[model samples]
Target chain A: MTGLKLFSRRILPQLVTLAVVVGLISIMFPGFFEISIANGRLYGSPIDILNRGAPVALLAIGMTLVIATGGIDLSVGAVMAICGAMAAWGITEGYGLGLTLLMALAAGLACGLWNGLLVAVLGIQPIVATLILMVAGRGIAQLITEGAILTFNHEGLIFFGSGSLFTIPTPIIIAIVTGALVTLIVRRSALGMLIEAIGINLRASTLAGVNTRVLLIAVYMASGLCAALAGVIAAADIRGADANNAGLWLELDAILAVVIGGTSLLGGRFSLIASLIGALIIQAVNTGILLSGFPPEFNLIIKAGIILIILVLQSPTIRTMVIFLSPAPVSQADTEKQAVNQ
Target chain B: MISKKALVGAGLLASMLMMSSSALAQTVGFSQIGSESGWRAAETTLTLQQAKERGIDLKFADAQQKQENQIKALRSFIAQGVDAILIAPVVATGWDSVLEEAKEAEIPVILLDRMVDSSDDLYLTAVGSDLVHEGSVAGQWLVDELGGKDCNVVELQGTTGSSPAIDRKNGFEQAIEGHANIKLIRSQTGDFTRTKGKEVMESFLKAEDGGKNICALYAHNDDMAVGAIQAIKEAGLKPGEDILVVSIDAVPDIFQAMAAGEANATVELTPNMAGPAFDALAAYMKDGTMPPKFIQTESKLYTQADDPQAVYEQKKDLGY
Candidate 1:
């Protein structure tokens, strides 16, 4: 497909929604988009949105794959807490930065392997398998931190959360790099097709000699690793591991981002760039609400209203209705192409 | 009423004589809410420390943030025939039956850090800081520190609609009500978390002319204050000097901030709720004095003038 046609077909809807949100925010606060530099780092509301949205964006990258495989991982948030606690514990124990990160990622891998085993080997439902860790993972994290916010002052480790490169925040850079690498790997190899096939029909994909078991485990492990990265960033941002609040209820946000990006929860094709945009949309609304100076009580109501409008605009029924009402006539081939793309 | 006073006086003397014999071996049961936050954890630690200092045979029960578990622990404490019981109830409702049982067992139940919805007479007294008073103390500190300067204040509220949030906001507003020099420019909820606190404060800084317009910040909790402090520093402003930081809940970390001159003042929602409860119990045991229905713990305010580092050291090991 031509780049313009591809952009118009797949990316335009989300981009428009994002633009509208940003436009509304800019209208409310005239300097919403103005970027300034301070302390050798980019500072502005836009940068804040990108920086704050890093965790969700990272999760969305992995979540897109999991959802595309027809499996849900409800344990990312708790995994975040677990990995953060591990990192905090390791740092405080005088471990080097490398060792602390390795331990944290290892913890994530272990959690992912546990969930994978339950789903792939025991034939448990994805939701149930992850639900176990979703509940217990926070407790494990609490134990690791001894039921306190484990504070660390390791500068090397803190750099990931707060340090900047080229005046851009480290978190933004990390998210971009992680997204690009994951996208390249999945698209470069046949792994994407195999995962999509398994999602479409697990029995058929298994009969077709796709290593469904190993692929399932690998997919969950990827999700776990992404969650660990998010956890580290969150912990590093605050310089502490808050077992109770770290990544609490963020799995839902990641899932919402995936759904808002036009990916089906029932499984099939997925788009990482769209999901990243959806994460940004969520953060933009958040930043807008904060800047609007509305009462705290109205925050949720306003966010819910804006998100509802965005979803309604993205609804397929409304899209078709808009097409039907359009002045321009669409050829049969173009209409068929639109349907297949969706 | 005069005759009743005489009769109570007589009863007091009679109980005092009987209580002195067993005073050294007094046993108490403490039912604590789970360590949900640093403050709650500190309360648990202080309770244990208080029990140990008094040489009281203390049986500690963790309710795990469940009303059911608290009720169960209360029943078991009553069955054990403890002299007095201290409970930090997880919730207000569903305590009528449990309190009634404790009363029937002749055990004085003193609530720690939280109150129950049962009749006042059901329990001896509830010892907790006045949430509104805590907020007002924080606000009053800001008002005094501003010294009639035309200062714009930004508030970091707790979870929306929470009792502490509402009461703290009200108390602060009440404190600065007549101060025309002070104005609340913006207010938002940070959900009482560091992450949300930092994120919300960043937007506040952006909206308020990059932290120049705002002169003070009031957070409902110290954690949020700490987060906002970071946001202020990131915006290239000195937190304590450029914008005064005042918040409630003197968690250990806040003292660290204060020692570093990053935070200005904090109103302590003192976790030593058990200290007063135990004192009242001791007084009641020594003489048949009925403690007040409610005991308001002190909402002490700490500023940079105070020895914040010493306080931090004292509180650091308290599990906060």
Candidate 2:
């Protein structure tokens, strides 16, 4: 009984909510369970959703960490663009794949360092600091590509986009692996505790010897690297480098995913697994809309509605109701009291 | 000494008259929609070059793809009292008021590359390609290739509510009206971005189960087509072979794709819309006689057999 209560307190509410939503969608779309898994590959339209969801999922994982630290990285999409342009340029210049990937990683790290320095060291607002990079990174990308699409003859990169590893899409595998790594870092490491502490109270954490500045910088750097990885995957998928549209509006999607996963925009709380599920939900909704023969314009309206619904459900009032209805009572009250105490 | 001073004063007066006459020669105020695309860039470059060659004092303002900025520049030009005005509108709507303002100032306005929505005839003439015809050309080519066989197609639309999107779709649909063989199975806006185009195409592929049953892909522009090709290839289908791809813009990448046999056909919406545009502007400057309400540029269909390599070589020379 105690174990069940603990489980309910920790994860049951989110799982139940997710189940209810998925059940409703499945009811509406009869073929939702008819996903074809041939030779270990999930065929049908869902694969596209999973594929398209990869980069956004990667970005949301990083954004979740940064938001948990009470910071925002607005330059993630631009970093993706810059990294893609650089990778494409390098490949076109006959650089080896390993070197090009390294260059992309280094560029992302440099951008993150610049943003981190402004926010953590210089005491600038996170939004303002990242916004500068958001604007300048795009300009840098354009400069790298000379405002043109850089086409390359790299077969290895193309394979990363289209080839399957043990019947799973490479991008999907990468996203899953990255998600696991991030979850481990956040759930098992001391850094995660420090981030959460700093997010909750920056001054208190500094006095507590948490090295808040270093944590802030580290979070942004991770976000940059995640965005760069996404860029490489995207470039590999397309077999071309398009600076203009490489990562356009990805930041918005990442923010939305994090928010939907019960991460507070104001920070101090986060869920890596929940964020992954949220990203999946968003991707599924997009795929559902497309498969249902609706016009693509309706996607914006539907996505906005989903975010609103999720946020409203996460509100304290609804959360209280959800807690009361979960068939267990004492632990729910304890968690509520603990939250109130915090 | 008195005679020398009198001569000097006369010479000074002559020089001032010459300056005034030169300044008044032909000041053409041009408010350009900033560099949004390669075509727009080429148009601007050609317009400036032509203006310089003709000794027309081109008072240029780049609106940077904003209607508000263009309107502000236009008002500034009006205040400066230039001889004539040229505008390349970013959109087809919301121009009646500003155009009326220009009209009230007695400056003739000429539209370039795109048209305005209002029927006010506020502008002298619009110099652009026949956008509807460009779409029709693509549709007709697809029809010929299909040879009266049933075919499923997916369309990659341009920006929603834009003139190109509306007109191109209309033209393509009109051409394919009686042809019961060709059907557009799925149509969605790619927002004219390569990424969005690929996203939409991925969905299309998934829904269609990565099959060659999808007859052809039609795009409003080459960038979207290129994106669709990527998605098609990713789905393990040969783009130009399994699914015939057609689009409007004959961009350099499109030619390269064609040369590589990854793209099948495209209608040339020449980026050099500037040549005819300047010719019309010069005629108007020479004599206040206005040209046609819409000056249509010529468009041609480019096919794989048309020697894309040669065309690529030629376009490189043309600074594409």
**What TM-score would every model get versus the actual structure?**
0.94, 0.84
Q: What is the C-alpha lDDT profile of model 2 across B164-193, one tens digit per residue?
A: 999899989988989998989988888887
Candidate 1 residue pairs in backbone clash: none
Q: What is the TM-score of chain A alone in each candidate?
A: 0.95, 0.88
Q: Which digits, one per residue and each the tens of the lDDT, describe model 1 over residues A281-301?
A: 998999999999999999989
Indicate which candidate wins on DockQ: 1
Top candidate (TM-score):
1
* Residue-level lDDT for A210 in candidate 2: 85
Clashing pairs in 2: none
lDDT of 1 by residue, B60-161 (tens): 776667777678778867875779999988888988988998898899999887778888999999898899888889888988887888999999999999
lDDT (0 to 1) per candidate: 0.90, 0.80
* CA lDDT for candidate 1: 0.90
- State residue B200's C-alpha deviation in candidate 1, in Å: 0.5
lDDT by residue (A1-342, candidate 2, tens digit) is 996676456554456656665675567656555555543455556577778889999999889988887889999999999988889888888888889989988998888888889989999998999999888888898788776677776887765665678778888998999999887877777877888888899999999898888889988999999999888887777777777788888888888888777778888867777777777777777766665556766767876786677778778898788777888688868999999999
